[model samples]
Target: MAAVRTNGERTVNRLAIVSVLIITMIFLAPIYWIASTAFKPRNLATTIPPTIVFTPEISPFVKLFTKRSQLRAPPSQEEYEAAPWWERLVFDGGEKVVRSGRGEVQLSGYPSRFMNSLIVAITSTVLAVGMGTFTAYGFSRFKVKGEDDLLFFILSTRMLPPVVVAIPMFLMYRAVGLNDTHLGLIILYTAFNLSFAVWLMKGFIDEIPKEYEEAALVDGYTRMQAFFKIVLPEAATGIAATAVFCFITAWNEYAFALIMTNRRAQTAPPFIPSQVGSGLPDWTVIASGTLLFLLPVAIFTFLLRNHLLRGMSFGAIRK
Candidate 1:
């Protein structure tokens, strides 16, 4: 009987491992496809059947930085038909291209757009976290008559779809001369991220014992001083997690960034898709851009992983 039970436990463990492996593959498949596409040339990229194994080339990577005038256009039907049979077998029609004048050309304005995204994300995260932390601190410590109701009201702002309010916000931004500007995006993202930050910080603040603040008070600390010196320190893990979430949201936001800014403030989300190399919708450029675009979030997450883990584990251990 004991042997049978042990066998059953081993079977369950094996099943669990298999399940995890399947899920991991499901998540990893897209990333692998994108990375593979990035390394492949246009010939492999636009293949109708989607080539699995092929020689990798850096032409697509180089084309990403070249100017439109400097880049080669798609091959014409005549040009496609004229290719040698052996070359034609491996090279698809879409892969044909050359520099505009057979001369060098400079890359596009990805750096500027990247900088714009960075500014908007960092500024918005800081404002959202700062304002939300203050408001959450107030809500956590104070006993208002309708505290729960007010908290619900604050949360209700996020329940509405962003599209529902886009028009109104756009009009308001234009009237106030805030449209197509960095400050405009910063303010908009901060307001959108505020609700989540407040809710997360409030829960974090509530975890601390009131005795700590009272002890500080007894030692001649002012209310504000105790909050800054005592409560804030304990809430650092939660604050880091909240800031990461806000940063990612603002960093990846597209619809708002697209509509709000036309040229000066466009981010990678909108800008990367429109980049054309050999033809319309350059797959290589798109894949390469996407791979690069993912780096900031990856780096930010790595940096704050410790805080995030602590914040996540806090609730489990608190009781």
Candidate 2:
């Protein structure tokens, strides 16, 4: 009977593992397609039956980063040989890199848009998470009048669909001369993410023992000092987890970014799709841009993966 039970448990474990693998592949298939398409030659990108195995080239990435025009004529052997490898890739595609009157290479707008995304996402995440941490700590450690009502009010801001306020927010931004500006998006994203940050952080802070702070207070630490020295360290996992979510939300935000900013403050999410011009769109270039855009979030999450795992299970077990 014990042997039968053991065998049953083993079978259950195997089934669970198989289920996880299937789900993981389902989630990863699109990412795999994007990564694969990004490296494919231009002609192969749109093949009816997708090319599973092929020689990978960096030309799509080169095209993704540079401005190019259809070649009027093939480069002479002299021009091709003298051209750098990256330029040759462009030439081989029957396109020439756009250059200034002084022959300086002109770059695509993607890099700047990517930078804008980083600036806004990073800045907003820091502000939202920082302010939320302080607010959460207060709510967790102290008694307040109408605390439940206030917390509900905070959380309610996120209850409505963001699109409901889009036009009103756009008008407000325009009236304030905040349209098409990095600061504008940063402020909006911070406000959007702050409530979520506070609620999530409060749970993590609640799990920390108040006695630790009391001990610090007895050691002559001011409340602020105790917070920074004691509470913050204890809540590091929560902070990391909250920051990751906030960053991703701000990074991938679309509608607000689309309506709010144009030339100067556009982000990768909006800019990547706009690469599809009136002509036959370069799928390879679009795929390459998407693949690159995914890296910052992927890297950020990977770096915080340990904390995120801990944060998820932080308060699950009780003493």
Which candidate should be chosen as best, given lDDT against the real structure?
Answer: 2
lDDT score of residue 146 within candidate 2: 99
CA lDDT of each prediction against the hidden true structure = 0.77, 0.88
Overall local distance difference test of candidate 2:
0.88
lDDT of model 1 at position 311: 36
Among residues 3 or more apart in sequence or in different chains, the pairs in candidate 2 whose N, CA or C atoms overlap within 3 Å are: none
lDDT of 1 by residue, 15-63 (tens): 9899999999999888889988987876578788988898876655555
Best by TM-score: 2
Query: Any residue pairs clashing in model 1, and if so which?
Result: 65-107
Off by over 4 Å in 2: 1-20, 304-319
Model 1, residue 198: displacement in angstroms? Answer: 0.5
- All candidates: CA RMSD (Å): 6.7, 2.9
Name the lDDT value of residue 136 in candidate 1. Answer: 90
Per-prediction TM-score: 0.80, 0.91
Compared with the true structure, what per-residue lDDT tens digits does model 2 show for residues 1-319? 2443677798987898999999999999999999999998999998878788999999999999999999998999999999999999999999999999999999999889999999999999999999999999989989989999999888888666778767888999889999999999999899988988888888889988999989999999999999999999988877988888889889999988988999899988889878786988999999999999998778977886655654334323323
